[model samples]
Target: MYKKLLLLLLFFKCFAGFAETIRTDVLVVGGGASGVAAAIQSARSKIKTILIEPGPWLGGSMTSGGMCILEGNRTLASGIYAEFKNHIRELYKPRLGYDTTTNAPLVFEPYTGAAILKRITDTVKNLTVKMNTPFTAVKKDGTGWEITIMQSGKAVTIKAKLVVDATELGDVAAAAGVLLTAGFDSRTDTKEELAPQNATNQIQDISYLAILKDYGRGIDRTIPQPAGYDATQYACLNNADIKKMLASAKLPNDKYLINWSDCANQYPITSDDLNPENREATFKKAKLRTLGLIYYLQTRLGFKNLGLTDDFKTTDHLPYLPLIRENRRAAGMVRMVLDDIYTPYTRGSQLYRTSIAVGDALPGQHYSIPGAPHINYPPFPAYSIPLGAVVVKEQENLLVTEKAMSVTHLVNSSISYPSVQMTLGQGVGATAAYCIFFETTTKNLKPRIIQGEILDFKGMLMPFADIKTTDRDYRAIQQIGATGLLQGIQKPNGNSARVLFMPDSVVHTAEIKPFLNEIYSRAFLWFNKEKPGELFTIGNLLSYISEMTLRDPKNLQDGIQKTWKTYYKFTTGFDATRPVTRREFAVLANRFFNPFARKVDMSGKFIN
Candidate 1:
């Protein structure tokens, strides 16, 4: 106890006086897509929010990294992400010929994206954006946190109720002494079959994403040959198929988001990218690599008109931040594995219930060794990012978002899209605000509460691409699908088969009984075996439910009526002989198994 007192005294002594001290309800470390979204949502919640960004601008990859191409399913994006996309459309509709109705042109100039983010934040009350500020240190100060930031060579201290590790590399988590997994986690560590036998710090290549604009014909805007320019490095340009892929990188605005695809713009870096001692040197090397690639494209690849765009002023048209694909991921409550997307989880688990965000990026291996068999992961169902995966273990008020969340390397490949990051950022920020309002830690907070709030915010917790919001049973279908109890039937064809959720078809007792048995340890009478093609009636469901709940089927009339009332609000006129629709089964199954089913409006907007 006395030693602890000494340590506390030392902590106070270290931050006894700083150049400036600021206090806020939340402190966001990075101004990336996730960080910006978090700050926006937190401030929108009427809390004192402060965002500290190392660069002069906001929008990390979307702007600073020149990743103007919007990847992932934009329809699943909600809240701040949706607003940002709409703002982009409004800003570029007349000038760039964007369709105001739909997101026709998913790409934009980097500066335009940054300016839009700045414009939105300027209007948000109680939000402070500290540009050109880098986070240096973080320590727990009583119930809150004290973060030391370096701004303009002056040390600034910020005390906040919560700290969000929105840094692209999980910097805040590192400073706060949180357990982080770097590079490829071992198969034993993540239980992913694709994971390396031994954890290696050799991460996926970081891209200094360059924005090159086409100047039509007869325009010579080619860059001068860069120093150490090697013509042989880009020999893949000779391959007709590879050249076609590179040519297809052109955006609608005639600007190309050149990051990868055999052009050799991506540079493989080790964990040294985050090393404080040699990080700057590593970044410089990466920059030179990209600059060389640009020169090669102009001089050797016969693209003389294509030159760097003037969108990024801070870095002289170069991206401010290198797009680091994989980094130090925080070891949160749930570490997402390959099976989370490829295989279904156990029914009724928290992972199945507490979805905060969703992503469905097709997993591609563009950075690995050439001729290495690329495992093209088939377009998967839009899977959820569980809330438990964002809450950092052993930390009271810290949340991990963006590419730094607790996910295996294999899983991160599919989930690290910029839109998904923004969606998750909003959820994390909202969760922080809720925590402050209720005066509770993230661990003690209930998953149902978080999930409900996210849904209310127009943020999607489930990503069913086939199911529209206006569908008659969107919410019920979503809730049941989330429990891992329902899965789409896969086509029996070859490797090109697509998974389909046949929503309108009548479900059979034999088809769905196994799922029910797995979720609820129920016993069924073996007197009669139901036929494979027989439609599962409402009466058949009620009898099975009765046996599952350990109640006699003969005496379950009142109980069945009560169950129907609880879920469907049906008072009388029940038709037990009627065939059960997929929608009806969804509502009944969700209401019975989901603990927070009471919070959902079973027959509201979901049932259009």
Candidate 2:
């Protein structure tokens, strides 16, 4: 009996040793929307990637949180976000009458969104996904990361070359010893005019979102009155019309996402609430607030038929995760501020050239927090996200995305949208791939090389509303726009705004000459010698290109004219004397001189 017991113990110990360590090129913690996108992009880039999620479903906000109504980037669809939007459209358009042609906001059921994401992730070759796995600990192992995760009630170790902190609340980054800033910023610290006099540990309001489905007109689907429910808590909803409120976030089918802030459902959070030990109790309070709002709608407003939907597969009908608007932000190489967005072109640091993602949402705060300062600012314009914002300065081989990116609290108001988060994820994924392929650290990697990889994957480096992904000159326009050679014009469109490239407009020498001189040394000599007119003609452009490349002027012009109609598909006949439009100039100059090839550092200064 003693011999048998010793042999059994030895067998169990050997099995534990064998199943202990798993290796991968990249390990992405938290399978949120950004985490999923990062894993997908890294896997598609031909790297062995593993994504781990605490919950069973992917898509933190849009799926588990039940906030399926996508905001911002309606026209700027690029990369995995575009692919996800297409999949949502294809599945729901015919059956649920979803409009696919127009640029309307896309909405869907939360479960369908998660299933679609699962299907998309399954198609990628070098990716491995583990659900019901929670991150436990992380430590540096030489140049890589040695992570411990809880799976099937046992601790499993993972060794990864790089780590991406895509957690909903920047948990991984915090664990990795990255400096984090939470809550409001002071005007003195961020140098923003709109910030308050002092900083606080108060973050944006979070909502425990509930999706309501109409069972039928006669059915009474109202939930039982929740504990600690108080009617006066939702006094703000007294004047709100029930129909109008329900219509605010109506999704596909007869469902509505109950993320209303007016009903006092938006719960305020502080640094204390972010503690893992206290998070559950904190979330419970938020859930109770949402239930109070729901009770107000059902008992008082006479909407008993609209009840919580079983979208998240939770025992309680509420969403599995809360819709977190803000969280702990990592301190990266560059901290993006409001000035970066307000005046991207004229900003002292040309961070626009290092753009990896784009966002056009206006900056505004939820009015749920009492004593929250109200600062009125100008309409927000589309802005580029610098690569440095996602790359951690203190930590090596680490990247943070989603709401945890390195941005000022003021700037986070605009970039926390789901679309921007996904694009940011794709950008960091490409960044990780580049570092792995070249065997370099994050500090040594070039921003333009990552931008090039994103462009090759049909990602938008700059948000140009008029330039669609299907356009033949999309790459040219995006690349040129990144170099600041052709800046976009911001136009107010109803309540929102967009940055138009105005490709059809005629190019003026004065508009581009300043940027040309900044980029090319010979451009100054060409402008001095030619003394070109206000209207830059095709002949003038060709002469400038000749000066830069030292090519034969006549030969360059002849080559451009030949391909002008055949390859470029320009409807207008090639003319040497006529003024060239922005589209014509962008295409020709991009093809011949290739100014976009010039490298820029993280500060947007030309390095070579």
Candidate 3:
């Protein structure tokens, strides 16, 4: 360990001159779902961009990290998130001629996800994605950022006008001196009803997910046993209810993800933790811990029949990715607080002003469990991610991405999914384009301007509806509400006569499928393209948009019409011939917009 530390120190000392400094319109760190979208958006905008990922492969959750299962509303997705799934569907399905039962074009594989990221980056000139590059530090240089990165034992530098920290953990922002809070800060501090009464520093333990393929009939395939398997020490999640039912041979849903299945703290560290100060040691520690997890599952539990597969395991069970849970968040113009989540009271949210993308999902797990290893799905309030959430408080040029953006612990629990993370990435990308076009700095932009830009961006809309009109923040609220970007709920007095907009009420993607499709149908008409009368696969449209947006960043408008047109033209192959797909106006849910984008309704269809 001493030798490794000394070697690292020496390497840093000698690598000064080797640090290459370049300039770009945007700098995206971390190549996960959000980072990929951020890079794609910036590159598509024709803006110079540099993307750095610590791992050799892309797709932090899907590839190196082994998070293949996409959570949240798959169909509610409109931008990069939609495109990724669509590509997986089209690329994998066009060859197979049939989709897997999940209705996803095909089940995703890690490498395929990685290659798709590479393909998008390679196709865009403005985007330059580098593998095995870990960010070391970030400095605010008055104009933008001076970011230092390490690769191949050398330091490289980038002077970026905008920086997106899509790292699974908020490494850059924390290093850059953003005011960061970890774990549960407390209800008094966070103003969250759900905040634990007692404050704690223990962030939820990151999950090391394993992909198990069941061949049906209780027959386990010859997948290999994971490395360092021991026969006497493994333990599964041990859910009492599941254990009782296990006698009947059934496993509950949560346990399948291996919640508390093993004690993973014993694994060794194999890489840097992406922290400049001690990432190498931290990462090496992570490796041993991960190995311990796999060991417990195989030999310790006597799952002799269970084996590992390199095809999925990728260089042992040590996920090439880190399951990060927290990061530094900029104190943006408007912090979406826990108070905003109550369905009974909150409304006229200033969030309506700066929302670029939006979503609603429940925060899943808490760190400390009351019993037996863990607890099942716990419910929290639904919420939206506004544009201000990703912009740093003082930085005039940068936008955050993925797990790096601002979110109180309450909402962070919900927005951390790879799909949602990708949505935020796309929103940041479009915003970067807007920032470039307007020659404006991110910090200088307001909610209205940001809203306008997003409405005109290239991705599809998450459903939103404005429950109120003629209010001071009407323009902002209506921008989302008119197009059904947010949802309208009962009035505070429980009277339906006067509707109140409960912007804080959490709405899941699953609840808004009808609204999503309605918006898509309108999108078809607005783009003057053919809308296949049949159930159109969301992926086809997503791919076309991604394919184009990856090249043209400003189709960046999210006004329902522009978004619809972009997707419609991309999907129907507009030969200037196809009966119009819509004849009437459509209204989407004010229920919930994917918490990441601010969309526009252009067909004069959704303006409330």
Candidate 4:
């Protein structure tokens, strides 16, 4: 009887140790800001999605990296990023005295930020999050991918129809034989004036950020001197004022984010440090530098109360991951460059039509490393990110987000911010869902269908500064802007610039005639009957719509006039003789002609 009981126990233990294979419609192989957004959006689209993270927490740089202070894109909130911002505001506003103003930078504790992300992710249906799970290997199987991940000391295989490579170093993409480029690009290679003359293996400096908290004036929370501590190494901070420096990144709960560069805490990394074998040791060195900085602040600066916070809940009290600014960039269908942001309207490729994400942040780069090339680019206006930028060139069923997407080294500075990355992740999720629903490959996907999905989810297709999400006609304006039927005016605002779509401005025949003629064949015949350089009146717009949609002008006019004041809420009465505003034309044209419904190729060219 004893031997039989022991055999039963042994059999149960053996059965529990067997590895399991899970099937999912989408698999996101990172729990960073972008990965979380991608998984949430993918699941929100009613697809079964799985998100795996090596770390214990979500929001990679925003929380685990101790970069809780968000910068740029103060007004361009959309999709998951907007949801994240709202969650932070709601969680901290009443209790923590957090700033809820529009233009104020978002500041919060690292742990609180991570919690907020987890809360938002928990409410999403069809999404499964696996923490402490590290990606092991990836292989292309049929039209989908078969990925191996380590969970609970066992290998778990996930067969996914679509895969999003949101890893910090693009490890999943690299393992799947995707073409990736690292380091800087030469001016001749990228054709950018601001790029270096020659390419180099050197990348941007990595910051192992530390979060310090004020534990009152009388307490002594100063830590012991870290190993290899040198006073001269931190001589740069000697002359700086302590009060001003600490206020630079002050958080809601008396916490401060120490990601400054004046003290030289930013550590330089080489291509070799990016290797998995060397990465751990490289991170140890960076952490030591941060610890040394913290010690310098406490002992030397006489701030004994400001000590390392237990926000991360780690033994060392340091952030879980260092703030990596650049990483392996995938070579996608189109490589975005500086010229794309500077001149999107008249560019060689009309990528605006294929836009899936919008970013308005100013471009910046950190060159703290020795002998690193520094080239300052002129201020650029808000621009749209193309769908092809995230679609890998070699892989048909794979997509990449965050810093791994296809953009030149120079263009990465603008698109790599947390908000922009989150929006891009949302776009990637919608694109993957569209492909799955249509049962088509990434190469065969149309831009308009994906753009429609983004709009359906209230995601911005164009970065129009003046347009707000609350505006009733926001979707129509964004759709028309994406089609290049209307272009936003780029105006300089202080150091940065913004693209404004002045909807109240009256439309001119010449300004829109060219685009109209290019998009619609009947537009040419209609323009032949109208005079050049004339104001595009409501009567003329109705005539044009009638010619394009082959509808009776009287019926179209009667329907618009009845709904103008009540349903459409147009303040101005429908007068055929009066000149039409951009807003009115966009709404009416969007309803009748539906120019945005036209199919566009990857290059944003209209398909015949």
Candidate lDDT values, in order: 0.71, 0.87, 0.54, 0.86
Kindly list the per-residue Cα lDDT of model 2 for residues 1-608, writing each as its tens digit: 99999999999999987789899999999888889999998888898999999998998888888878887788888999899999999888787556786477878898898999999999999999999999899999877898899989999999999999888888888888888888889999999998998998888888999989988899888788988999998887778876887787888879998878745688887867967888999999999999888888889888898888877677778899898888889989999998888788888899999998888667658757678776676777888999999999988899998888999998887788777788778888899888888888888879888888898888889889899888989999999999888888889766566889999899999899998888788888888899999999989999988888889988988888899899999889999999999998999888878888898888898886
lDDT of 4 by residue, 43-68 (tens): 88888899999999998888888878
User: In terms of lDDT, which candidate is stronger, 1 or 3?
Assistant: 1
Can you give the TM-score per candidate against the true fold? 0.81, 0.97, 0.65, 0.95
Candidate 3 stretches with Cα past 4 Å from truth are: 1-19, 94-107, 151-153, 212-293, 300-302, 312-317, 342-345, 366-383, 452-461, 464-608
When sorted by lDDT, best at the front, the candidate numbers are 2, 4, 1, 3
Clashes of each: 0, 0, 69, 0
lDDT of 1 by residue, 1-608 (tens): 99999999988876666437888889888999889988998888888899999998898877888878776655465668878887877667676545454424366788888999999999999899999999888989876899999877988789998889888878888888888777667778777666667777666677788888879888888776776778877776665453455455655577777876555777766676666677788778778778887787777667788888877774447888888777778888777776766554443233645677767555545564443333445545557777777888888899888767888877787667787788888878888877887888776756556666666666666666556555655666766665545665544333323334566666776666665544444333421443323788777766655555556776675666666656565434457787766666676666544523433211110111
Q: Write the per-residue lDDT of candidate 3 for residues 1-608, one digit (tens) a residue.
A: 99999999999867755547777778888888888888887777678888888887888876677665564534345556666777776765654334434323224666677888788678788678888888877888877788988867977788887778777767777777776555555668766666666655444445555543333444443435444554333344332343343223211221122323234332222113244577555655555545555455444443434433444445654466556544444565455665454441234443533456655444545443233122222333333466677877755676666555666666666677677777777777877777776777875554445455444443432232232122233334445443343454422322111233544343333333344555454443423453333333233233224333343423322333354545333233332123221110111212122222433221112222
Name the better of 1 and 2 by lDDT: 2
- What global local distance difference test value does model 2 have? 0.87
Highest TM-score model number: 2
Rate residue 585 of model 3 by lDDT: 12
Displacement of residue 177 (Cα, Å) in model 3 is 1.7
Off by over 4 Å in 1: 1-19, 90-105, 151-153, 240-247, 346-350, 368-379, 470-473, 484-502, 510-534, 538-576, 587-595, 598-608
